[model samples]
Target chain A: MEMLMNPSQMTKKYFTPGVMLVSLIALNGLIFLALRLIFGVGAITNLDNQHPWGIWIGIDVAAGVALAAGGFTTAALGHIMHREEYEVVIRPALLTALLGYTFVALSVAIDLGRWYSIWHPLIFWNGNSVLFEVGICVMIYVSVLYIEFLPIVTKKFIGNVRFKGMLAKLNSPVDKLLRMLDRGLDKTMFIFIIAGVVLSCLHQSSLGTLMVIAGPKMHPLWQTPILPLLFLISAICVGFPMVIMESLIASRSFKLKPEMHVLSKLGSYIGPMLGIYLAFKVIDILIREAFVYLMVLSTESVMFSIEIIFGIILPMRLFFSKVVRESPLGIFIASMLVILGVVLNRLNNFIVAYNPPYATTSYFPSIGEISVTLGFVCIEVLMYRLIVKYFPIISIPEKAGVFKTKYSIQGSK
Target chain B: MATQGRRDFLKSLSAIGISTIGVAGITPSITKASPENILSKDRMGVLVDTTVCIGCRKCEWACKNAHDMPSGSIDDYENESVFDNKRRPDYSALTVVNKYQNDKTGSPINVKVQCMHCDQPACVSACIVGAFSKKENGSVVWDESKCIGCRYCMVACPFQIPSFDYHKALEPEIRKCDFCFDRTAEGKLPACIEICPVEAITYGRREDLVQVAQEKIKNYPERYNNHILGETEVGGTSWMYMAGVDFKNLDFPTLGDKSAPGVSESIQHGIFSYFVPPVALYALLGGVMWISKNRDKKEEN
Candidate 1:
């Protein structure tokens, strides 16, 4: 194991001042207060009966969950696939998943009308409802995520002799029992991993299935039985690219070593997934006989075309190209495009493309809604930074010379 | 070597067995509706003659009054310029009359839009909460009390009929025409049929309605189109239409015979029915995990 950074250096470099963090938290709190007090959803939001869900459901929840898919995808690749090189990025991806899911839970709390009655779904089972399936699955998966993160938390908290001794006395036979439980959990980790994958698949598809019930209210260009499948496939495609984006951003910001090798390897999976996704997307449109609608250059059609080109086709091309896949900057740009694509696809399905002929209302998220979303994102980033700082998250460390030289140069400057 | 091979075979068999077990646990019980139940031969419905409609908005008024809904004044319809553009059902309005210009008639056709009340109502099937249900007499009704307000019925209604009361704070209802299920239960015609001045909207047993529609087309070949709208669309609606011109000219969607619920529910059940894929996925992951764990153990030894 590499030597730890001295406490002073760690504190100076890693931890942002508490005041700045608190101010960010306060800003979010103020937004929450405004949402609760000043506005019913209509006062602040453009949502109507036509567009029931908006940016909160589409981007903040759906896209957020898809981005979090990186956790299971990476863990499955590293631990299950036994690609040990990818193991370095696993914990960060897990951290991302944890934060992403927490944000989804928060989004649900904000969006639900009877927010207090949220527990009813947990207590009462509506087996037939797709939302019920999604709600239950997401709730369970979030718990599973934190359980997966337990070892990292324990390793960080239970440090040397003093902490170990304190824990040891309390541990007793229960300690041995707990260790056995951990081993059993590790052995059965595949069950939860598979369960997570299954649940994610079910809920992600159900997210699109939620729109399937919208009938003629949904623009014909997007309304089809195949939407659920498209959503599931797109989620998997988005997962790898999101991981790349998150890792690259973290590496650049923290002056950590880049994981270009793993990212480029991930490009191989993403390229083909995008290809399969685009192929099926075209087939779905054709089969539904919705291709004719695309011929008319209406606003909906134009937006649809732009979404396909910019979100799917362009990103796929960039990802597939060897030169672009290998370059750090190229991969980063492609990852951004992929992320943008997923967001646009979800937003188009949920908001922009939802047309109720009786009620021709448009939605732009209120400032409060936008602030809450941003605040949730900030919280996610803060949690990630804190976890990585305290826990042995990423396996590859910054070269000693590189770290020293950078700090010395910064001091001199 | 022989024992090792036997053990590997056993492992593979157990993996497959585990997957099948998992799938069996979650698969929905397939209780197919009897063919008699499936086919609604005696299904009753209404046939609206759009050419005869006077744009009186009487149906709208009668439906609201009968259902005890809040009435909108003439100004509400006029200010919205509802006639200028085709209007659909709203949270407050269960039905609407829209003026459609037909080149064949060289005049306007006032088409009243409401729930088609499909023979196989997608809204009924798509509703997991049992909020929307089809009655024995053929009317599809919604029980708002059971609704968790998930709005699946809104999405499932091919006619775009179900409208939600999104503005309401406490208890918002999903508003749509129930084919006047309550009035029909009392052996009375729907409020719209009772109040229609022109007799443009006729309510009866759907079979009788179809005959009535055909007889009108046969009697006035010039006035009515031979085609009976909703006779086969989305596997037949409880409500049908007879138009002077082609239905498409009036902005009616030319949907296929396959019901929306049939397509979606089939896919839902097909993927989820057997629980096979998830089980298979688990077995694959488990096998891989076991192999890796064993390899690690060997290395340690």
Candidate 2:
């Protein structure tokens, strides 16, 4: 395995003929976004007064934010927990989070009717509103994430190029700016890291608070006084799994051996975190007596059962097994299930469980809505590929044996 | 005595530290008083006597006309075919009248359906941008300029009264019964109150209306149901209803006396009370950072 110091040294192929499908999906999404802007939300969406928010809030913003939990969780484990062994996966996770949040902000703009008034939350403070908290935290957190990523940018750009023409005169100043930024970040990076984690916690839980205000509108199965706690816990549980899944998938895509040793240990943390989440969930149900509704075999009941059993409990059990953790495929499948569980939980809270009594019919996302969501996802993937190809986001090994399954098994144990 | 004094001093220190943390947590919530807009005692309201409504649909005609919406000829609103389906107040129609049979008398009980304009309105509390407000005149009004059209108000309203102009391409407003804020401001009754041929609706101070409703129910126990529709449900709406038939049969939701925003507001404010929980969380995180840094030094050595 070979490691390239600069992104320019990596392959710069734009198309492989196989990526046409992705490109086409992204194009369709871009067209629908244009339609939404020109004709208004009514022209392109199946959204009515009853269903004010659709897949844009549920899938694109809510689930997208939860999926990005890998960044903060891995940062805590590696930097805060001083787990040097987990450092291999932290940069990729951080990059994923930065891109993830950028798209969430973009998705919120698309979802708003008056997209231009997106900055209202910043200036006109509604401190009582959970959404106000979410908006402010996200705005600040995005800035913090970029600031955290600056050292990487400076490291890549400094001393690499001496520009010519008009650029030649500015080259020394640019180099000086990078050096200053790099130096400043080295001393103060921990403060931003701490702030990032704090901000993430505030917003992730506040997302649940948004749903909590729906109160009677949300079905009892999903609605609870501790909804904010549930949301925060589920996000924390999924964070490590997300990091593991991304690392494994990236290794496979880049034709490098998978980081099974670090990932399996990461998998071990999921079981305990998942245990804490499940305990709260069961207690919440019992305390509320919502278990009665779960017995009716209705859509909410069935969907809730699938979310808990297949997405959570099944994967949690898988993570506990030593053999499952040791095997690359086993850990991947387990992490995927946890990710699916968190995604399902967010979607269910935002859409399925929200039933307006006066609504003439149930809401289903229009093709345009689905396309826009898919387009954002495609953008995340393409951006990740582009950044990883160009930057030193993914750490590489000096020898071939480091990523072997047997090597991982022996090392992790 | 020396040992006892030392123990007492240490106990006092622990108690002081713990109390300081507790004070820090609660001060934020206390200083920033809960944003509960108090409804005025003398606010105006309407008393809707369903037993006397007569199913005329004249209020519907008057409402549309007064709001500058298309009424399509006042005579057209009297068509009986509209009664075949129960209709809600929409963008074009600010109010509607539905007919249901009084179970005991086998007579038609006419019910007027529109925004209740609750004293503690859920829409006002749920709106993120403070677009909805319960006015001094007991009108729950929406400010179009402030509304980002998130439509959270629609979801929050227990009555589901707020309707969006979904068909409009640009500058669509959330259409609802404004309780005739414009007319009432000019010392005129709401269009529905003025247009009722039977004089079934009584418009007055909310406190006076409650007394009037109570006296009527007490006087004609056989003619009216034992309960008032909006008197207590969802923290008492301005529009009170007295009907021969049970409100549930007349399509009124069976909501408790609790205000719609009460439960959600309590839980949200409770968790975030004082901002102490978040501060404690950051402290714990800082502890982790310190521990990890120490661990790193040990490993390096």
* lDDT of model 1, residue B191: 92
* Model 2 vs. true fold: TM: 0.90
- Cα lDDT tens digits, model 1, A95-186, are 78888999898777666543445566654443445666678779988988877776544433332323255576754555555555544444
- Provide TM-scores for the models: 0.81, 0.90
TM-score of chain A of each: 0.86, 0.93
TM-score of 1: 0.81
- The DockQ of each candidate is 0.20, 0.26
What are the root-mean-square deviations of the candidates from the true structure over C-alphas?
6.9, 6.8
- Native A-B contact fraction in model 1: 0.20
> Which pairs of residues collide in model 2?
A7-A390
- The CA lDDT at B94 in model 2 is 80
Model 1 residue A381 CA deviation (Å) reads 2.9
lDDT of 2 by residue, B77-126 (tens): 77888888878787788898888876688888888989999887778767
C-alpha lDDT of all candidate models, in order: 0.71, 0.79
| Candidate 1 CAPRI assessment class | incorrect
| lDDT by residue (tens digit), candidate 1, B1-301 | 1112336534654775676676466434322331125556676788898888888888888889888988767445435366876667877789988887777757778989988888777777666445666667777888755665556566567777777766554455678888888887788889999989899988777899888888989999999889999988887888899987888878787677876566555566566556665566666666675576467546647
